[model samples]
Target: MTTGIGQEREKNMEYDLGAEVAEWMLSQTGAPDGARSTTTLMGLQWDVFPGVWHPNPGTRLFTSWLPIADGCRLLEVGCAAGVTCVVAARGGCTRVVGVDIYPAATDNTRRNAARHGVAGRVEALTSDLFAELDEDDVFDVICSNPPLVKAPESRRIDTATEQMVYDPGYELHRRFFREVGPHLADDGRIYMLTSETLADPAELRKLAAEAGFTGRVHASEAIGIPAPVMGSTPAVVAAADEHGVVRVDFTMLEFQRG
Candidate 1:
């Protein structure tokens, strides 16, 4: 039996611990000015900038799994350094558009596309979700590996880099589902990646349903998180086992109009 006062205290402690571990995970990224680094994926050289959402296991996995067909138009939301954008263009996608809220990320995407000689087929734009996209713009395949954390009000996110990690109240995701349909062509599909270690996939599906979209888990694979941060993050604690091994799963969810 717990009193209301005791429950409040426990909640506060959880928030504090989650914040502490979140800061540690972010520090590992060399963020804010993720000074230029390069990595090879999908057989192409891509320059990674830290201020943007640089390629992580989630991004890499999403890129490889996206269904990009020859001559299909593709749009990638939160297209951090354009890993998927470049791959789509080189994979024979007729047009690839990558949008990010950070100008630096969009710039980085442009640079990488040009680096791989796919600039002619790739366009990078600085847009907050679908805000900057033209109403008539439609894509055959729309994909996003969005921020997985449902940031609580206790956490302070002051930079674009922080925005890449925390989606406060899931406002960004709500906006995505509500606005995405118009941008998708007929017979098109949406691909979004979620992680059990970061957020609730069920909640995401609920949001999609509220927006009149049907979603299903298209793929799922277990992945590991750094062991040390497991206990402090309350949101992801249930994802770990008795041995303190984090049993995280990266789930790819597909959506279409109901």
Candidate 2:
């Protein structure tokens, strides 16, 4: 087990500048509760600053491989700081929409869209999963960094960014996979991030089947220590024990309509 104040430092050594600042802000409160996440991501300078959550490694990695196509309709569920939406607009997606449960996220997305001069093509809305989207409206590309990390259930969610990390019963995963297909055009693709070791492959396939879609691991990479979010939950602990170490995989999954 990697247990040491020194080990924590070692883990942080791998994070980029913005992520490091965001992590520090998460660990602080009181006066620092006002700390803001940087707008810069993956070297793409942003016109507006981040309001609440910072972009994670999964979001950064996934944006690098986003398939570019002209006039494609793109949607980002759980858009935190609007990074994916901005990235899509920058990549020339004709219509881009960002939906999040948080008002802060929607505001940030729209503001950033304008800041990027893509306001005409990009829009943001606050929605509970797919509740706010019309059934007739479909997307050619849908992506998200859902709350896939399973931690010991906490009645109180910490920070907005923490919202992306903790999913008690994996409810977000179930709902996203079960309902996402309807809003996805027949030719659309779904991109998302989930824990490599924690996500159940069979269960994911089953969820996709129920939604009339197919899911597969498009890419995955080992990430820094997951100790921060790897609470004392039995299953998580057991997996860590079984591995003889605690390692996290930042995986990108692709889903397609059947």
Candidate 3:
């Protein structure tokens, strides 16, 4: 009888561990704040939280420049949880489609959109960008905050695998530009953001030109970490000296479809 009881306890413990692992995975994707969230951005009340894609600083820059009028169709690629989708909906876009490789992320987006009463205005899908999208499906605006950082060789996955977030290479941005042109309406525009470390402005502009896009620099900013607090390594100090800046610089490139 004691042996049977011990076996039952072990099973219970295993069940608990499995539950914990599931919860942790969910948290890593994004933490939902119940069904809704209230956040303050630039002194304005904004809705955001877990299951919603958190707008990175680059997204914010593009959002600020958006021509928020009725009847605009917006597409956001790599939209994890759809924070930017909600923002676009709130900004008066008639239709917003957010695509990601992860079904859970899209599911989060759907829930968050419903929470904000914008579910009708937003659609989240698991798609490989152009793969699932109809050839003729075009948008007024397209935006993305792609995973631009290259992973170390040891952790690299098969190149042929379709992932929601994976580093293709420095030239992935070039390919994105090439592919986007065909899907953009004549008057359509694209807002893309990536770090200087990942892509240079000149190279991006050239790629856009090849893709039949007229590119312009919309905004640039230096992301800084306090030097004293960031212990000085030789490389860090050298970078600071060269740029006369201790901050990582980022540029927002806007492309207009001609």
Candidate 4:
């Protein structure tokens, strides 16, 4: 289903639309490609590059559940290559904005939106979470496919090449919740994606709660961890094995600011 869904994600897990995730039962099988130089999703071709997050299963699941509204303002957090943002704009959002810490992501998002014929409705910016975001630019809907992997410190991390999937102490996600509050409209909703490898559903809910928001599992899939993915970060695997976690649950979370 996806070669490399997210830039920080190195696991070659794949997901098909409309498939019952339970049926897989943590099956680790081969996917199309790990590099994912080019791919197609939701009937659109994408030019994905290294260091940019690809549209993984969590992404597809979240986007499929997007509460599309007429002329609604939409925001996509951490839009790596602008795949989901482009989809939202093409689907008829009045205006769509994408934000990412990586300059490549913003550049690609803008270029892809234009390529997809939605440039007028799409704008992308390079920002660390909400730092560069304008105060008055509240969005009716927000989506995130954040990096959730708990990468071992020794694992190679190159901002120009690879994003750290390891949250260390889940700090990145925690910061997202803490900083995302002000940018959300009064009646806005957020659809976010993450994996069990980093945090469980209950833990995710608690994190959101601490940040003055309520989050729940909206869509989920059980992914089997293969040898290659496990080997990429033996330290993380060892940690998970210590906790008896052999399977990763890919989840989509829906929450909102009150």
Q: Specify the highest-lDDT model's number.
A: 1
lDDT of 1 by residue, 1-258 (tens): 989999998666555544554565566455664477887666667787767665766677898888878989999998888889999998999989999988878998999989989999999999888888899999999999887777875767887667777888888899899889899998899999886556668889999999988999988887566556544365446434676655556899999988
| Model 3 accuracy (lDDT, Cα) | 0.63
Ranking by lDDT: 1, 4, 2, 3
**Candidate 4 on 120-212: residue-level lDDT in tens?**
999999998888888888899988876565444564554333353445456677788888888788989888876654544576678899988
Query: Each model's C-alpha lDDT?
Result: 0.81, 0.67, 0.63, 0.68
- The candidate that wins on TM-score is 1
Per-residue lDDT of model 2, residues 1-258, tens digit only: 667987876444423222332344354322224544444677765433344565656568777766757888998888766778887888889888889987877887887777778888888889988889988889998888776544444535766656655565566677888778678888789987765454444665677678778888888876554433634333334434343444556677788877
- TM-score on alpha carbons, each prediction: 0.83, 0.73, 0.67, 0.73
Which regions of candidate 2 deviate over 4 angstroms? 1-37, 47-51, 152-162, 197-202, 224-247
| TM-score (C-alpha) between model 2 and the true structure | 0.73
* RMSD to truth, every model: 4.1, 7.9, 15.1, 9.9
